[model samples]
Target: MKTRIKFSKEGNLRFVGHLDMMRYFQKANRRAELPVAYSEGFHPHQIMSFAAPLGMGLEGKAEYFDLRITEEGAATLHSAEAAERLNREMAEGIRILSFLRLPDDSPNCMSIVHAADYEILFRAVAPEDKIAGQFVDGSAYRSLTGDEERSLRAAVDELLQRKEIPVQKTGKKGNLRELDLRPMIHALRCEDNRLRCTVAQGSEANLKPELLLSALFSLDTARPFAAMPRRVVRTELYDSAGKTLESYGTIF
Candidate 1:
């Protein structure tokens, strides 16, 4: 049988790389005494896979991974109880959110990821000086004059109306190429000193929230948001039909 585990990474742990994260979970599974399956062969490895690994330095509100349970008593483990046992093994910055059974015919979590929602809060809020931190820019960061708020709002509006928003990407061999990010952005709104955005996510095409903000900042040079600190939190991930990964299975 297979199980999907939902968890969140925050605080200092956000710096943990994907490979390290896998090792951490493997150890956690053993510490929790779960019936985790192992690959067959000369060197056995845990049968675990993550769904759309988050980028380093960013926080995630909802994240998921799947595992194979092969022990004889695995079927008897209650979903909630499994989450509880796993929670005990998590470090301070990571938390187990849910455990659910995936249908036999269900697709891999990583493959079906189509879109993502994010909330950004910049560390700096003052109109004149930079307050560095993590987040998306909006009027909500700090007390902004009516004019400053309007300026930020106007920047976002102008960006969305453009035919293409281009950014440079480095190829595997270190070649730089310009990529357009406009179409990948499904939606964006700046209000309450925060920026809420939805963008294409997954293997096909991805648009980073930072690129969107940088584009907006470039449009209006009055406020230097590009140099300010950035803080981003991915709120949730969705499938092509607009459903969260959690919706595909039931949580106990």
Candidate 2:
């Protein structure tokens, strides 16, 4: 039997890397005594796989992982009770949101992740600093003209209109590959201090949202962009059709 685990990472746990998180769960499941299946070998490891690895400093709202379980009365272990058992053993920043029993034919979580929604919160930059700074250094932040605000809104539209936005993508072997980032950015929006965006993610094609954001920041030709995002929070994961991956499974 296979089980899908949905959880969230925040606070200090956001600093934990992917490999460490996997090890944490290994020890966690062992302590919980969940019947997680292990591969047959002298150094057998738990049969677990993650949907997508969250970046070190980012927070994940809905993250998923898959694990196989012993079929001995697996039905009884497929519900909130199982999640509760794991939760008791979890540290403060990680919470097990759901324990789903996927359909027998369903693919693993990693292969099915095609898109992700995210919210990027940026630090405040003074309005005068936003204005090329030469003519506006003495101005107050709130006193900016309507034209200045309108330009801020138009910057996002102009970025998406570019024919090609090239970025250097590093390969696993440390090779550099120049790739166009336009098509992978499915959606982008800039509010006062936040950006809500959706971008491609999968083996077929992947574009980190930060790349798209960097391109957007570059649109401000007059002023040097003063701040990077203060925080990035992954809101959800989806399939190619933009359907939430969790929607494809059944509650255990």
TM-score of each predicted structure versus truth: 0.89, 0.84
Which window of 10 residues has the lowest lDDT sum in candidate 2?
Answer: 132-141
Consecutive 10-residue window with the lowest summed lDDT within model 1: 131-140
Candidate 1, 1-252: lDDT as tens digits: 777888988777778888899999999999999988899999999888888878888889898998888757465888989999999999887899999888878888999999999987766445574433333223233443467667777878888888988888888999999999898999998876667899999999888777777677787632565675557889899999999998887653
lDDT per residue, candidate 2, 1-252, as tens digits? 878899999766888999999999999999999998889989999999999998887888899999888888485676788899999999887999988888878889999999999876543355434432221113222223456446655876787788888888779999999999888888887665456888988888887766766777777731333253256779899988777777766776
Clashing pairs in model 2, backbone N/Cα/C closer than 3 A:
none
Model 2 residue 90 lDDT score? 92
Query: Model 2 Cα displacement at 4 (Å)?
Result: 0.8
Best by lDDT: 1
Off by over 4 Å in 2: 123-152, 221-229
Q: What is the lDDT of residue 140 in candidate 2?
A: 21
Cα-lDDT of candidate 2:
0.77
Error of 2 at 65 (Å): 0.1
